[model samples]
Target: MQGEEQWFSRTPGVEARQKIELDMVNSLLTSVAFASDPSRQLALEIIAEQFEQPATIRTHPTPRAQLIEIVRTYARNPDGLRVLVDVVASFDPQSFGTVRLRQLFDEWQAAPSFTDDDWSAFRSALGDVVLPQLTELFHLATRNRRHRPPAHCKTAWHYFVHLTDLNAGADSVPPYMIFLERVAPLLPSSTGQELRMRNHRLASELGLITAVNEIHLHERESLPPQHHTAYLVIQLESDGIDPERYTLSHWYQWDADGWHPERGEDRTVSILEIENEVERLVFDMETNWVEAVETVTLEFILPWELINAPVDWWRKESHSSRPTPLTMDYPVVVRSLERLRTHRWHRAWHVRWQRLNTDPTSVLPYWSKPAGKNYHTLLETDLKSDLRYACLVLSEPPLPDSSGRTEIETALRAGLPVIIWHRRDCGSPDFREAVQQMLAGETLAQLPILARKLRGEALRLDLADRESHIGRHLTMLWDDPERQPEVSRSYGTPEEGIR
Candidate 1:
């Protein structure tokens, strides 16, 4: 009732209110149809400023639907208004935009102004059109190098924060962080790779970009050379479009990676050697997994801070040349991915994730290709009991995906042995799992996960050595547990790896 009274309070002069001609319901359509650019821009401008206000419980429901409809009616040709999101995201977070705009909205909402309901209605509509549109814009901004100038994330962040403030109830949090969460999990392996090229923050979080060779590998069969295999290409803001270059500024990425120093250059050169090892692995694996080589480390050095320190820096640092005097450990994903497409090994059946976002970190290092299948896509008919396949557990460090644990248990109940490739980077849950494996005894069903990285195995042994590495793993995996009581090739005793 109090809320209603406050809502009613907005009905300033009964005579004045009655005299107001435009109805809130059709204001947007009317405005878009008749208002000049000055007038229409005012509406957007005012709403943009109002977003600075702290949230409060609305006394009268703001004419949310009607106002949003107004925006849609006006923004009918969305392409012309593609900047609608960019505009909204442009507001200065410090204190809205102009005092003039904020006062206009504040005054109108307070009384019998012809636009009383329009302000709230307009704001409601702004969010409806803007939030989802941001996802699209963000995707473009992340991918298209041309968007660098205006769709700056800094501006977007400010606009997003204010927009959240204006739209939220007292308890609501800002939307960017939530949007980021959505972005991370939603990214596919392919999209993540593109984002990595741009050095987007989420790409780093996902480990898409690394600190090794600056060689880029997005060259698909149809695409021309967008990759920098030998040098980290540089692009200047003034350069625009196809990327501008002056001198061996192409090698500027080396300087940025601390390679301006001889020591840094030397270390980078050593990392290049690793890339060769990865190439060898790809060749061996594709020719035949049994005869293949594997990498103990596909190192990518992260230059996160140097890139973000300034736009000037980013302009100067586009691509880094591949390693010089390179040693072992550089990860060559391009070659690996191509080869993986033809490999004959089978992936896990009916995979389920425990977390909302899929972590490709574990997936990529574990498999030569990627764990492309997700559990959520499966149907009941797709699931069957007493299956003879192995279950691979990718227990996320913080928490597994919602259904991951349940699916693993189901496999166990069905008398299936879950085989996990283990290594030195055992996840947070490895201790508990080791305890479980120990208690279950030496049954194949209870074997501790097999991680190739156990005891830094990848680091010590070149995966290229077929008999000692791949052969040993293949023999252990294929050997019949019942017939062989204890598999001789179980290298370090699966029990030792649990630690």
Candidate 2:
């Protein structure tokens, strides 16, 4: 095995360079932006045709799927991988006029290897960035307690090893590059890559070959990306007999690991008092999860009737005289409590969710128009068609009297993952345009972030006039079938005979 000195050597073998290229290709190709780009398919097809041997690739429905197929086909072949690296490095998006790929590839190549002096400088820079936040980092690192570092992990490097050095065992310190990338997002300082690049130039002035060359496979074995934003799921189940009263159940989701049920009293409240109860729930969220997780998104699981409730506008009773809506602090989205209980539509829900992520442009919203009493049947037919509409935009408030309720239910039954509507003015041209503007992009997952922006705009309006704007009344049933909360089997009304 090579010593630490030889590991940081300036002259790397051809194998090392090939490994670096492979890493670059994987990172660039798997990126959401690159995978979804319109130009990718043609570029990939042309590249395949350039091969000496006929590369018979299978056809996939979406660009993302196709890109994944391309990666699987070419990643192992050195010549094919080199071609991909070059093509992706030259990608230029026509619509956005952004040229990021070339710049990123250039930086990757330009970054220098670490000399002993460069490593020292890099470590010192890390200390400057990470030392002040060391206590905070320690707390975050040891949040689970069982995974806490041993007493001997007193230095910064040891603590870093505990945090990011996953496959290398408990006490093995990570390379300088790995350490920088792990701690780059730490508060108040120069970035990890930036520090490395700067040290390269300084070292070159002293006649050292300081540029990074060999790809460190250990970088791939680092910890999964930290989820800074946690989710607070507030599920409101209606009392079967009473329309106004509900039994509230709440869960806190830390990450993709799924929701953990919080032990609490079975608190029932009237519709009028629900907002105040939600305010208390928000407080509990702050006290319990928000400090550790920087941001908390509020996901309200509501029945059909309360789906349009202006829960986002509900103000928290804060110390300030003029407290803002929950939307100002958190990205608030609603989920169908009815849909959660029904397993019949879940397969469609899951399928549509996958389609939405893979091919968002194809999953356009089905805009409803005011029609006869049998309008919902027509809407269901439209949703279930080969068009595979995953989103529903209502033409009226989904009240019992209006067609919105039927429209929403039809979409839910057909497994549409998204439902957007202005609570009061679904017929307005402004709302139509707003929906258009929001769904113009290929990212259906960013709906929550966009909805938050709209809510913030609504909050800026006078309280009396706020209701006039679609932003104030905008509600989206942005349900993700994958990230659902754990509910009791007997909690809600199960299917007809399952009990």
Candidate 3:
């Protein structure tokens, strides 16, 4: 009656709340042992209620140990696990100190070493009752770990290696490898490869060989650039069954400091791994050459399809909102149409030449069949023959639907400046901020203007500092006549410009 009165009261002190909670926990344990279904549910409800109370209502050791045991034991039981998970999830490590919980977790993690039997028991308990909840608990633990940054000199790699070594039987490979792979490309080449090799060696040493394959670099590139004459074309590849079906990601360069990926530095060429029924993995590397003699086209072969075909098909339906048969309105198709429209005049006149030189029917698509006159005849006559400079234009948001952003980014990376006409309604505030930064030289605006400015300044400055500074080295090479052959060799075979 006293406990019932306190439970119904508007406010109860720490002592009363703790006594009630302890009694409820003991009752729940009794009910679980006796297999009393109704009492089990009632006990869960009582635990939930106690958890909802302020932290001040529960003291450190008692509540912490009780919750840890609940998580460690009943984590496999659907209802019981849910109750424990809810309590832990509700805790704010910042507001309510997580010190005790963390300590208990460390103990639980180390419990196996106390005795071989303890390890076996934990494994059995996890396999039977807690396996389903493992992912969620793992995420919770990871989040908590991230909240308080590890001490200086302690990298994530350190923690990962330590844990995997300590808990050799735990299936830590999938999640750990996934995180590493995601961040790998962003790391410096040397550092990235070192970490990867370390992971591979550790996995092998621990006999976790299944995870070793995941550490291998599936994508390979040709080589790095030499000088002003040539640029490196990195070919990336994956072991995926159908390579051509996957869209190639933009090639990124390490910035001036050799740390971060350069912003706005990309190539106009689109690389894809195409999988045809006949050809298992065909790399369709596409790029246009307007002026440069050579270009580096990176071919990436992934072990997995970067774009899942079914997901892509669903995405097409959702984005275009066209019926299945009418889904030809997708971005890729739309882009081809836009390019056709822009090149109508060139195409029509070229048809006359192509008829004599090769093919004429290809030009017919631009003309409206019903109308006698060609739709793009006027555009053809206005075309200039000796136009030396091409403008890379950025007029709208680089939405996936518009490949313009990719095109513009590629041009800038190739050291071309772009002309951007600001369209206020087409982009968000963040995009506008990016544009402002590009103009001010604070950030690499991925605009051609920045490239032009940097190149122009480099040409005017004295380059006596070549050996010491990388910028000077690039500048010296830009001026060097001897390096022409080397630079030229790095540039891949030039192709026609993308319209």
Candidate 1 structure quality by residue, lDDT tens digits, 1-499: 2232222212353332222212222333333321344554554554445344412222222444434433333233323122333233234322222222222222223333223343333233222233434534332322211111122223333333323222221223223223333332234555434433333342344453332112122212121222221112111111112222111111111111112211111111222233333233334323432321222211121111111111110111113363221112222110011111211211222232111013322221111112335542331123333132333332321123424333333332222223232211224344335423433443333232232222224335554752233212210111111111111121233332112
> Could you list the CA RMSD of all candidates, in the order they appear?
24.9, 21.4, 22.7
Report the Cα lDDT for candidate 3: 0.30
What is the full ranking by TM-score, best candidate first?
Answer: 2, 3, 1
Provide the lDDT at 127 for model 2: 39
The candidate with the higher lDDT, 1 or 3, is: 3
Worst 10 residues of 2 by lDDT: 209-218
* Residue 48, candidate 3: alpha-carbon lDDT: 57
Error of 2 at 256 (Å): 4.8
Instruction: Quote each prediction's TM-score.
Output: 0.21, 0.54, 0.23
Candidate 2, residues 279-309, lDDT tens digits: the string is 9988866765523644778889987778889
Alpha-carbon shift of residue 371 in model 3 (angstroms): 17
Q: What is candidate 3's TM-score against the reference?
A: 0.23
- Model 2 segments more than 4 A misplaced: 1-225, 241-243, 256-265, 318-320, 489-493, 496-499
- Per-residue lDDT tens digits for candidate 3, residues 366-452, read 111112244223222222221221222343434454433443333222222122323222234443444454444432222333433
Q: How many clashes does each candidate structure show, in the order listed?
A: 37, 6, 30
